[model samples]
Target: MDKNLRIGIAVLALVGFGALIYSSNSKQARQIAASATQAPATQASAVGRAIVEVKVPEFEGKAVLGQLAYVAKCASCHGENAVGQVGVAPPLVHKIYEPSHHGDMAFVMAAKNGVRSHHWTFGNMPPVDGITDAEVGTIIAYVRTLQRANGIY
Candidate 1:
């Protein structure tokens, strides 16, 4: 194979192996994730939006718990990666969700009481059925992690 083709195959193989390992060691991994801290968001946007500049966690702690809870609770509307589906829901991986505007509590409350369609045309968001306040927090952490990874804070 050509050099670039060989390199692409290697990258894909590494990613696949990583996913396999991550899933196999999920429980142990979550413990380690607890020690991870949220990367601070500090990018300035001249267009009046906040760019997320936080580092992603290594799949441990609350973020992990949140990831589970999110898969169960929020992923349906928010999309698998919280990137919201077009004509379905708005992406959580966008700039409109700067910490200054959509505080952590907003996510918490939104899970508890649902939210109105203030930003998108996805209509109203009713409260989630089987998640708790604490789960919401962790889920927010997971969402933040995703947003940061996508450069949205």
Candidate 2:
């Protein structure tokens, strides 16, 4: 082939490859957007919640372990230190959470059985699996201490 023809073919191949990459990337982006829109109520609710600043004092014993478990398990939607997600999850540090109304047992029940949305618009609180009742108790202890510090008692 003539030199000019060879160069033209090379340019076309490069252009074709570039187009292929761009097309693939665009399709993947659209797919991600679609999946997000179709996400399960639980997932969408969790993602909708915003990340917030979390501050907690020193803790000991079970409460300390509870904090670890909470961070690993509930911090996603509940917000760190149980600060809460406005539309996604209710704040655990609020006055409404006083033991008088939402007893410690409530936490256990919710963790085990999942609770329907009532207080906040965040769909439903799905039952968290793989965590024992005792661990739930520790998490409640951590939450209660935080609540008391924030004047929830």
Candidate 3:
């Protein structure tokens, strides 16, 4: 083939590849946006009711300790077993909190610095008071365990 023809083919191939990448990325972004807009069940009357049914598997080792810490520190708004609360808080066991999405450090930062509401309409999460970083780690372990069991991972 002529040199110019070869260059033209190469340019076309690159453009095609870039289009493919953009298409894939846009689809993923749309999916994430769709999920984020679909809020969980919320009730005006029930403030702390469980919004989703959570299947809690028996805990062991660090997860056991984590569960206790989560209950003491996070359950009031996040709900029992991290199922979430109606008109109060979002569920930690939800796909939104999966490690690939929210990660462990998100939990730590949210606890330390508070989080602005984006996913749920319940409102902003004020920085949790009187909870140490160590406790937050344990709480993440517990929530992650629950998330995995519930197929969020």
**Number of the top candidate by TM-score?**
3
TM-scores, one per candidate: 0.60, 0.63, 0.72
The reply for model 1, stretches above 4 Å from the true place, is 1-57
On lDDT, the stronger of 1 and 3 is 3
The per-candidate count of clashes, in order, stands at 4, 0, 0
Error of 2 at 129 (Å): 1.7
- Candidate 3, residue 85: Cα displacement in angstroms equals 0.9
Which pairs in model 3 have colliding backbones?
Answer: none
Could you give candidate 2's per-residue lDDT for residues 1-153 as a string of tens digits? 999999999999999999999999767755543443233666655554533344566787899999999998898878888877645566687655689989998899999999986544457889998979988999998998887776677
In order, candidate lDDTs are: 0.68, 0.76, 0.82
Q: In candidate 3, which residue ranges exceed 4 Å CA deviation?
A: 1-44
Worst 10 residues of 2 by lDDT: 30-39
Please provide the root mean square deviation of candidate 1 (C-alpha atoms, Å): 18.1
State the lDDT of candidate 3 residue by residue for 1-153, as single tens digits: 999999999999999999999999777766654443344455345656666888899888788989999889889888889877766687788877899989999999999999998766667899999999889988888888888889988
